[model samples]
Target: MSRVRNGLIGRGLIPVWLLLPIVALFAVGYVLPLSQLVLKSLQSEGSWSLKSYLEIAHSPTFFWIVLRTLTLAATVTLICLLVAYPLAYMIARCSPRVASLMLLVVTLPYLTSVLIRTYGWIVLLGPSGPINKTLLQLGVISEPLQMVFNAAGVYIGMVQVQLPLMVFPLYAALARVNPSLTKAAQSLGSPPTDAFLRVTLPASMPGLVSGCTLVFLSCLGFYITPELLGGPDDYLIAQGISLRVLILGNFSDAAAQSSLLLLAVIMIFLVFRRRIAEELDDSSRFDDISPLGATASGLAARRPIVERASLLSHHVGLRIHEALTSVRRPLLRFFAGLALLLLTLPFAVVIPLAFSDAPYLTFPPPGYSLRWFSRLFSNTQWLDALSFSLRWAGLSALLSVAVGVPAAFALVRHRFPGRLAIYLLLISPLIVPHVVMAVSLFFALAGTSLIGSPLAFALGYAIIGAPYAVVVTIAGLKRFDRTLERAATSLGANQITILRTVTLPLLLPTLASAAIFAFIVGFDDVVFGLFLSGPNATPLPMRMWDNIRLEISPQIAVVAVMFLAVLAILGLLRLFVGAAIEGRRSQAKT
Candidate 1:
């Protein structure tokens, strides 16, 4: 038995077999459903036709919606880049402890549900919210501004939600840059501003590109933020598709819209695929100086014109730098602090509003009370939704780990044909928009009895959760020391024994992180719940979405606070476990 197992492992058969489960899942859950969607889009009254496409091309409403979607996505991407660059740069230049704390602040809102964040914006930006209230008290404005339910609200909400996606990639890129290179440029007679522009900026291009691509792609598929915050005129493509299916009962039209949207996503993804991969793999060092040197030599040949232009710019930059030298650091700190505060503004507002004595949404409650908390707990609908969310999120995490762990092991431990293709297939969910996946899953499961079942929700959520699991686990496996496994083998242990005693034990931290990420993916999901969730299986996000769209109350804030409390508890527990583990390791070393 041991020889057979060893032979299978040696020949790479074990790794190949381990990949089969995820491959099968994607085939049934992703590929076939998308194929069905395409087919449905092509058929009209059971015959092939382009009627839906033709209608979309001719309809001014749809044309405007598509145009708006693209325009919004582009604008949001640009704004996020502008706002995130300075913050990321500031964080990168900080001490490691400070950088970690700043990153934690930036990422906390990201872990919260988009629905919750959008609600936070509603409370903060509404006429009765804090901003307008403060402005009124100070006599800044005669009346409250119409901030929500318009294009302004959409932009503000979308940017706040997407800011972290931009900051993280930019931080990663900027952090990898060698500080000496900037100093070297300054030493070679470049001004501080000029050095950053030519040296630091160019070095961070990979991250800039990655961050912009992610933000743009995400904005393109935004449904929750726009739906809850924007007016009817601010309609987007995702909303159009949802309307056609859910309200109009026109599956063909919805499928056609989804197909076009999916095509756009695929095209953009393919164009930036290589750069995105480089960023994710942390493989782009930006250390090659040959290109910079070549450009400089080329410029030297045209020095008469270039030198005059460069001299004027350098002189201007020097004067400006001198003028602002005393205030530059303080200015950067202020802007960066403001940006971080913007990221946490939603929770900062919502937590306080949860305790408001007022029956409705208000800032700085007349008096603090637990009425909303009591109401939320006593409400059956809220309890049922919360129950459903927790149960399915837990199941989804388990399902993701069960399949993702083996696939990670296979990809890391063995060389095989089609390995790259397999890895891509596993991570494709992350590339495809959540709305598109939700639509595809809806069509795929409609023919089965599982359409509104908890099992169906788990399966769909797992598809979204699995990519994070595979990526995190693969990273862990790569960083793991294989020597311990060899030592176990030398003790006459079989493959299974070695895996159980040496591999799994050491990989526990990685697996736990992966599971937490997967759980969060399911828990924070609103896109999937929009299309697939039914009366019995509605997740908490879905319930929250309903309340925000229909009624404005303090109970919603209570739910948001409760969810944040849960997350805080989980985070603290993780820190405690990590400290205990480190202490044990210290003892062993001693």
Candidate 2:
């Protein structure tokens, strides 16, 4: 038996037991559910039909909504790219310490929940909110502008939330620009501005394109932001799907919309497949020849008309070049600072409004009080939602880690046929947008009696959360030493005993990190809550989503502030506490 086991191990198949559990979970959690959804979508009146798809295709409302969603996503992508370019340039050129600090500011949007960040935008952009109040006091307008609950609010909120996604990628691209190219350009009598335009800018296109593709897809899938901030007239595709399912009970219609939307995403992804790889790859090698880019660079590097005329004209051109170069660096830093300030403003606005003693959401509080927070704690409805959200998050985290760790181990250690297929199946929940997942799971589980239960929420979230844990566990496993496991196997220990005594203990910290990530994802989720939650089983984010639409209150502001504070604590723990522990262990080892 030992010889057979060793032979299998030598063939890179010893750690294969975990593969079955992962495949089974993926089948139940994703493949079977989504397959049923696709089958239902193709059937109508107990017969296979394209009626739903045809109806949606011919409907003007569907066309208008989808077009609007695409337009918003493109606009947001452009805004993010334009804003992040200078910011990324400045950061890339800064000292490492300064860049790290600034990067933290850029990361604020990602740290807080999307639901919380969107709420912050509401308090800042509403008619009676800070932007309106400032404009009113400044006499910029005769009356307060209705910014929230409209298209403008949706645009602003989407851009703000998605900007960080753009910046970090562009910065990574810029940081990798070879300084020697710029130096060579300068050595050839080019000004700093000319050097950057000719050399540095073109090299960063990969990162910019990657960021734009990512932000476009992410914005196209907007759920809670547009719902909370957009007017009745400003529905996006995701919002429309939810309304069809929850309001009209039109699962067939919703499924058709989801299928179309998924197709659109797939097409977009196929178009930019190379650019999207920048998310994981070290650097994008832009060896593709672009006649347009080459022409533009040649044009920009060409001298002004006057400079081609005379010596005096050339002297004046040199002065102009010096002047632009002189101000360019400072200008880049200033605007970059302003853009980063906008990233922090959403959460900054939440703190004062949360403590406001005012009857409604107000900034620069007339007086400070804990009234809203007290109300947050005392309300039984809120208390119940909080309890349910926490329990579901915990259980979902456990499920995610249990499912993901095995999957990661099997993939890392095995050399089996159909390996890539299983990997893709496990990670499909992440690739498929949240709207599709929610709609498909809602209809599939609604076939059973699980739709309105907390268990439904956990299962749905676990399916999504598993991908995060899997990615993190895979990273940790790549750093793990296989020799230790082999040594244990040779010491008369079975595979399970080796994993218990050696593998699990070694990867314990990584598993904890995966659990924490799963917890955050499950807790912050609003889509599953939107589709599957009952009134009695509402999660905290769902409560926030409801209050924004049905009841306007300062209490929501309190919750947003709480989210900020709790996330800050977690960030601190992840940074400082983890570092301290690792430091102590290093010292002990030494």
Best model per TM-score:
1
Model 2 Cα lDDT, one tens digit per residue, 220-254: 87788888889989989998888888899888888
Clash list (residue pairs), candidate 2: none
Instruction: Give the least accurate 10-residue stretch of model 2, judged by summed lDDT.
Output: 278-287
* Candidate 1 lDDT, 163-277, residue by residue in tens: 9999988998788777777788678876666566656676677789989998998888888899989998899999988888788989999999999998898788878877755
TM-score of each: 0.92, 0.85
Query: Which stretches of candidate 2 lie above 4 Å from their native place?
Result: 1-11, 14-19, 270-323, 409-426, 474-512, 584-590
Give the clash count for each candidate: 0, 0
lDDT of candidate 2 vs native? 0.78
Q: For candidate 1, give the lDDT of residue 276.
A: 59
For each candidate, the alpha-carbon lDDT, in order, equals 0.83, 0.78
Report lDDT (Cα) of residue 335, candidate 1.
83
